[model samples]
Target: MDRAPFHPGPPAEVTATPAGDRWTLRFVRDLRHPPERVWAALTDPARLREWAPFLADRDLSTPGDAVLTLVDGDAVVAQPATVRRAEPPRLLEYTWDEDLLRWELTRTADGTRLTLWHTVADRGLLPMVAAGWHLCVDVAERLLAGDPIGPIRGAEAIGFGWTELRDTYARRLGDA
Candidate 1:
């Protein structure tokens, strides 16, 4: 399949809300695939490596502690994370470093509605994180559409249209 050219464009609709001592960054995307398919991409390491920023030591469909290996340039940093919630194709929540990451999948008329809530304590990193996630989500959508475009990592991920996305999100978040 011929892949669509990657474009930074406008950032996805993201909302940052305060959650106690942290802020939750929420991203919603309507995928043209079923929850099962999307869930596989979200939980399976093989599928995740195709798009996600991190790789899991084990299948994330189970509730337990799993090692998360984040892609940083040529290096992979491993971290221990406990799965807070795992319910097949519907929900998955786990620890992302010191923060909590939650993914919710809902069946929609056209496809699946995927929502990601990432708890962030560093307010300064919001734009950067948001941009990185926007790119990751785009890559996942492309992969599910049968036009996988490989992985973007570390400096490349941040350099790959991140500044534009960050600027866009900053404006949207009114943090500029």
Candidate 2:
């Protein structure tokens, strides 16, 4: 049976390495679309909401500084995310809590090369975090190609991402 084209396997040449508790996911896809088109998909709030599940409501057209709100069921996670690195059709970075989230886009011979890096909470929530980020990247790629892929349900929906939140605190030395 043929699979839906909305989701594509990570580009054959992709790499992920452990960085302390954080992980770095770097891959390059030859998206058929132009960088400007891809950039807007990454920066526009309406487009973002369409692709990313956590974002219920937010605006990005007036891109400068804003308080971003992300929802996971009844709980709401708000972070003061800023466009730290903006190069237009190139790089975008912001603060997702303490960890830094960045997206690096390059206009390649084939298409746009995107590098998404997130220094989010790991150890306990690592697996779910990885899955969520992985899904986000998939959605971005699909959206650009005008595929019918849907927004991803965050780690919370599966009941595993939050299960390990307490483990992070237990690791503190002499904290018992």
For all candidates in order, the CA lDDT equals: 0.84, 0.58
Candidate 1 accuracy as lDDT: 0.84
Measured against the true structure, the TM-scores of the candidates, in listed sequence, are 0.92, 0.67
lDDT of residue 127 for candidate 2: 40
Runs in model 2 with CA error above 4 Å? 1-8, 11-30, 56-64, 73-75, 121-127, 155-176
lDDT tens digits, residue span 1-176, model 1: 33346765345778888889788888787888999999999999899998888888888998899998899778989888899899989999999779799999999998898899988887667777788888888888888988888777678865568778888888777682
After superposing candidate 1, which stretches have Cα over 4 Å from the reference? 1-4
On lDDT, the leading prediction is 1
Model 1 / residue 139 / CA error / Å: 0.6
- Report clash pairs, candidate 1: none
Candidate 2 lDDT at 123 equals: 40
lDDT of 2 by residue, 123-165 (tens): 4444444455555656667777776366555543344232232
lDDT accuracy of residue 149 in candidate 2: 61
